[model samples]
Target: MNANVLRYSAFTTDPAGGNPAGVVLDARGMPEADMQRIAAEVGYSETAFLLPREDGTFEVRYFSPLAEVPFCGHATIAATVAHAEANGAGEKVLHTRAGRVRVQVDEQFTATLTSVEPRMAPLDPDDLDRLLAVLRWHRDELDPALAPAVAYAGAWHPIIAVSTRDRLARLDYDFDALSGLMAQRGWTTLNLIWRADADTFHARNPFPPGGVVEDPATGAAAAALGAYLAHNEALPADRVFRVHQGDDLGRPSRIGVTVPEDPREGIRVSGTAVRITDAANQAG
Candidate 1:
């Protein structure tokens, strides 16, 4: 197994500010067990393993510390950036477990991933109550405009919009309880958010199911948020927004989101990634 993993932080240019993801540019002979073990050893929220195909497209898989997830946005960004850095910037088609993902890397090395067709589902009231209980949040604390729902781009994320930024900042929750509930419901993360304005938002994601307490920047969740906003008819004129995350964790990240006019089209998530050097990793 000649798996060479490169570390990169997505959603930020600074290595220490965004979410770190392990990228294996080539994993031709690597087994699934080895991928899972490598992910665990990397100790990041997620790691991306790419197997290059004969036709230029790549087959990709994402593994967290605990299990394999269908897709991961941050890892995708990190992996593609790492690929662009080595092979020069351009487009790549990724065959993920969820669906086909089209990623484009600009000359400046900013990677934008267009997710597979997004969908939204109603959040069962009983399930919402259980989730709130585990999160230690009251019903009144939620934002009235953005109703809670399960949104899926590649993975399922429950979109919970809080009324205040302070509420979003205070993110203490029952780890075991939330993890059990997420596993039962097949949710990747809880997309807890606060709308700063029409075009600005603040987000915090709890990823207990991935064996991580929180995700500094979550591209999948950002895509889900775009879907949620479009579904609720709450999107701005241009249907574009910026999401600021990881402030509470001290590793700030910025994610750009674009929702298409047609509901059938997938959401577009754009971000930059920086390679994590040995010194930077040690400092972090």
Candidate 2:
């Protein structure tokens, strides 16, 4: 095993409750192929590689077991927390393929990533129709008040708002179909959401493009959703909310997002991460 390779679960205090990510803090000399191979060997949904810069910044890259992705939220959170634990908590700038992301970690090991400027686009009616069929959802299942759209906050995701928690719980989907559509549209994940209240939401993400059925905690998607809701005036003036995800997968996770008054600015996604012990991996 690579000594530099560390395992951490993001978005939860318990190592077994959040999204597992392999974090390589000193991957400066590693080749792209080696990083990919290591990510595959780690067998997590995603792994983060950090190449330190002379200016104290980092050139970060994310990879799944099957392919490389532009940005990954869970991996970023995990990596920052791991770094803070080893080197002391502070701020770090990550230069990702998508954009530059600013992250800060406090002494408590809570990490927050501020996404790039968020943008929203309309989800084509034709695509929405097809997506619903693949996901076994009907038009009536959608929340009429919460409009669906494609939002980008470091990464692109289709923000879908369902009407009921029951509708969101049944997550069976046509993996191949959804993955193909997302690939063609260049989306990272399908942010399937159900608004729980004025300040709470339930979400599930389909990440077949990364060879994973679902992402337990997706901070990028949460950030995007915050922007989406804020721009549409759908959220409260406070623009703070908590998202519950991964319950159906038995690895429950929570993500907190704060949307600023300026919609074009970055959104803040905060969560806790814990180092995963080998014993926990063996138990799973």
Candidate 3:
């Protein structure tokens, strides 16, 4: 019944920074309930459970403290890096609840995940109203350029682009109300973002359903965002975009997003991971 639980924080070299996740190297023999309990005990935003297949690919499941998620970006990054550190860096295929994900780990401890095909849909007017109310934000605060929409890579996230960085910095939400709305809409997080420049953005994610108030570095949301930008032709194709998150939470993380010309290849979300020490683990 024992499983190897490796702790790694993705999106930053410093263990104290970025988003921390637990990786279960061998979840083959474990039951669903066992995986849930382990994830709850680990108490990170998410933990990845891997069951290797005969073809060298693996079935990957992600569980948060409260429930299972179809996919999780930070956990994928952390788990892939942890796997590479132990098994050598190379391409790995993961069969997630969302779909197939291809990850490449380099020698430098950086892992990049190619998301499933991404898409965006218009947000329901009433749902958007409720979300804005819960966040205590006015319609005028939203950026007119980036309209409200539900974007999906592996999971669905509602993209709410704020007009100013200050609006994004002040993140206060009605947890119960937002959680209720998210549960109803099958949303993983509310991607709150502010466009600082063409290539740089400031963002925050409210994941009340996952039992986390906010995520420091959200790889799923980043992929969705990249898709949104590319789909709308918002940014120059040759440019690299940066997403800065966790600064408000003090864990400050940076996510690098690259959008190639081929839209079907999915966006590239790259980040580094660091091992957490005992003291840091205790504190978290």
Candidate 4:
């Protein structure tokens, strides 16, 4: 690829772990088709292309190998850290298809992104039933305390909480069925979760809509989970929680999420990223 495609692993400091994303720091004037092509060539779950504006802000677009997505949290973090390493670490606004996302880059190059206003919606019973059947999960396996619902924070993800951590670890689902249902509902991912306590949880994300079987680390889903916990009063107000993911897939990652007192405010999802010096490296 002729584009200056940089690779970075998000949510983990080690390149061997976390989700890998492609970042095109200067993609101004490039056609959308070209950006999509680069993302396809890179073969990551998602890639970010940034168009710098005169106001020092960026108009960002995210593309998976198969299609364009409204938002991608991992890609946002990877791109911001790459920019901070070159420019200075601070804050900036990114205009995405979902909304304006505010990002802060610390001196350590850990990027924290505040999502757009989040909202939750009830999942249709029929659809939820079908999803459960596809995942081979029985109704008894669900956690009644955490109702299944769809949550959005820049991107839409269906939140499904299981009864046990063992159930969360054994994730095998029908890709076609899940992908068809997700595409019909415009869902970016299925946020499958298991809560260990008030402040600790484990998660897995199925992103077949992005042509990936599963994502090692999903920041967007983590943000939606935080909003869900807040909306349901499942946790204390103004709390920060930890999400452990991808351990079953051998790409262990950790994500931290904070919910504010205000219900309408965006959830903050923060994590560190490691730069993959070679663009040819495997990520995600």
Best by TM-score: 1
Q: Give the TM-score comparing model 3 with the true structure, all chains together.
A: 0.96
Candidate 2 lDDT, 233-252, residue by residue in tens: 89875889999999989899
Residues 25-119, model 4: lDDT tens digits: 88888888898888898999999999999999999999999999999999999999999998999997899999999999999999999999998
Error of 1 at 203 (Å): 0.5
Q: After superposition, how far is residue 97 of candidate 4 from its true place, in Å?
A: 0.5
lDDT of 3 by residue, 47-93 (tens): 99999999999999999999999999999999999889889999989
Question: Alpha carbon lDDT of residue 123, candidate 1?
Answer: 97
Q: lDDT score, residue 106, model 1?
A: 99
lDDT of each: 0.93, 0.90, 0.90, 0.91
Model 1 TM-score relative to the real fold: 0.97
For model 2, name the residue pairs that clash: none
lDDT of 3 at 14: 90
Candidate 4 backbone clash number: 1
TM-scores for the candidates: 0.97, 0.96, 0.96, 0.97
Off by over 4 Å in 4: 281-284
Residue 179 in model 2: lDDT = 92
Better of 1 and 3 by TM-score: 1
